[model samples]
Target: MANTSFLQLSPRAQRLLKTTQDFVEQECIPAEAIYFAQMAPIGSTDRWLVVPPIIEQLKAKAKELGLWNLFLPKIYPEGPGLTNLEYALLCEVLGRSFIAPEATNTAAPDTGNMEVLAKYGNQKQKDKWLKPLMEGKIRSAFCMTEPAVASSDATNIRTAISREGDSYVITGRKWWISGAGDPRCKIYLVMGKHHGSKEEPHRQQSVVLVPADTPGITVVRPLPVFGYDDAPHGHCEILFENVRVPAENMILGEGRGFEIIQGRLGPGRIHHCMRAIGMASRALDYHLNRATDPARKTFGKLLHQHGSAAHELALSRIELEQARLMVLKAADTIDLHGPKKAMVEIAMAKVVVPTMALKVMDRAIQAHGAAGVSNDIPLAYMYASMRTLRIADGPDEVHIRQIAQTELKRAAQVKDQLKHKEERERSLRSRL
Candidate 1:
């Protein structure tokens, strides 16, 4: 078992985490039905971009309980000042219900965006955007993936941000941009190449803050995941044609998009993994509930009485526990040594948690038979969301490659040290 002694959170974080657990159970979980009803398409208009009323109610309650913005770390003096390890525990609680994260103001794209602004944004930029985002008054989008290039290699981004006088013109087509479908989405963090710049591949990219209503900017459509267009926070495809923004909107200066990417994505990936553990735990609960029902029997035995079914439940519990421990460890590392030093651990958690969650959800769905595939349970949707994580942030293969490289480098260093030690002993032996 992984040691959890290092995860002793502060009293403030512990109190907030308990409050968050209660809020998610009492408020967010019960509001799922209302959220689903409001998300359904009505008449000729697509209501997918509308935020449900229940969400606002929950958000208000969350603010009153002081459970808002828990994802922000102590580095940002203006935030709740929770460490990454502490926030990870709170995030797992929020992940139990789909509505909880947004209610607590810890939803992605926004969390990542807030971190970027807090770390890199100038005072004016912070005043204009970060303040509203932190307040949960408005949402934002991250536009980096391009339709034309393999976005996994972020350096392949072809969007152009060219300088002209006091402004920069941005032209690109970005897809899979989460949170763009929200009507409250007011700003975008767009990544593009600095036109005519001769900087290295990694240094050539820059991220700029572009207002959603900027001239020539258009939201083309929302992309569906396994036929579910995640309403009000849909993943969208957008176009920017000669969209102009003041040069001052550039984050951390020109040719520094990769730097921001590294800083923003490290924490974002771990947050997703922590949430995955929560989702898996819920799925396991659903599975156990169904499996233990005496009314439902298979082969003249209750589901839980069957040896295979019981084993499956036991395996899921073990997997979920292991995944949770790995995520906590990763969060602790990021908290202690900074994100750069924690990359290997983050990559490991990112690869492990989603895959484990998906498997647990798959077994849970199987336990429910046909109802699992239907909207009667949240398993199908949860499965789809968890499945996406394997490709999001960075794909499993990418993380695997990174982990392998790190391990191989360490092995090489050990081998060199052993060789030097052996040679030194031989020299001493010859003298004897």
Candidate 2:
């Protein structure tokens, strides 16, 4: 049976729910061998070349079923008319398999980048970029982090973007640039220092749209997670030296990069957390099944029936539930308040979900003995991905700081309100 917690879709969301569920079971599951083969430690160029056509075919089938573009806000015409709350459920469904998001054209970097353009880009800029992006004709990358700086503190980014005439020249080295290695990747939402005084650090940075084919842009290397380099769509290190683009490429004007991030990262962060939940859930299932298997058991008792293994499995379930509820609460906050207003909840979830997922993965890995960390199971890979997230997006400490400030301010506001009510009661009693 499929997972019941896959998503709770409304009547209108039923189509997307059914479509993605069917696609994962049929196409994505069947492609696991091909997927793993292509991702094998010793890579083959043929395996890499062969998988694209297979992915394209699966994507075409999904598009034909009207499952395309369900990841974006329904406020935009490109996606199914669903709110963030609605899409969070669907993202969980796609999270079941690593390949499912791409099959539906709802993968990361692109999803976040598309939202950035849709929310901030001008008509000409949207026409040149957003349209193709929404159509899934090409993929894109977000170039915000740098190799030399503590990218978690984005204010410290040193990538240089200087203005000259009608153009802006960019120069920097960025690592962990996800989706940049794909053959289909055609654009990059590059964030860097624009022509500005260094005194205003935040204002000094700007976001510009740079074509993947722009001159002087170099793919330095693809970084491996643990030991696997996710080919065709791996995280990459890119070098931009004297790369120039039309000044028209700047999105929502300069110094507003921070403003754009305000709108961009909220959804992206939650989406990653939701998917992490699904991945952990699946890993738990694998561990449970492996433990109980008659052939796999060492003693007469099934692995799941054993004291140590069962304890970890039980803890995994509890942790998974806790993380899910927290993510849902964060999603609700985003729905109730705007993303900016719900910043504390968003940051808390970004910190909490990944930590929970990492723990769940660790337990599952131990259950599998040494094989858990082996490429034979997805546990190792999922763990690596989740671990990076602790430092990626924003670090745990940064989010904790924001959450602390929010709680302090909220407590102070409540205290003041109560004091005012007491004062008003005292005045009324004296008048009486």
lDDT of 2 by residue, 38-75 (tens): 54345655422334566777788888988788877766
Candidate 2's displacement at residue 179, Å, is 1.2
Model 2 pairs whose backbones collide: none
Tens-place lDDT per residue, model 1, 7-92, is: 66677876787788889888899899988887757432356556788889889999999988989898888688888888888899
Candidate 2 Cα deviation (angstroms), residue 323: 0.9
Range of the 10 consecutive residues with the lowest summed lDDT in candidate 1: 1-10
Each candidate structure's TM-score, on Cα atoms with residue i matched to residue i, is 0.95, 0.91
Q: State which candidate has the highest TM-score.
A: 1
Alpha-carbon error at 394 in model 1, in Å? 1.2
- Candidate 2 structure, TM-score to reference: 0.91
Per-model lDDT: 0.91, 0.82
- Backbone clash total for model 1 is 0
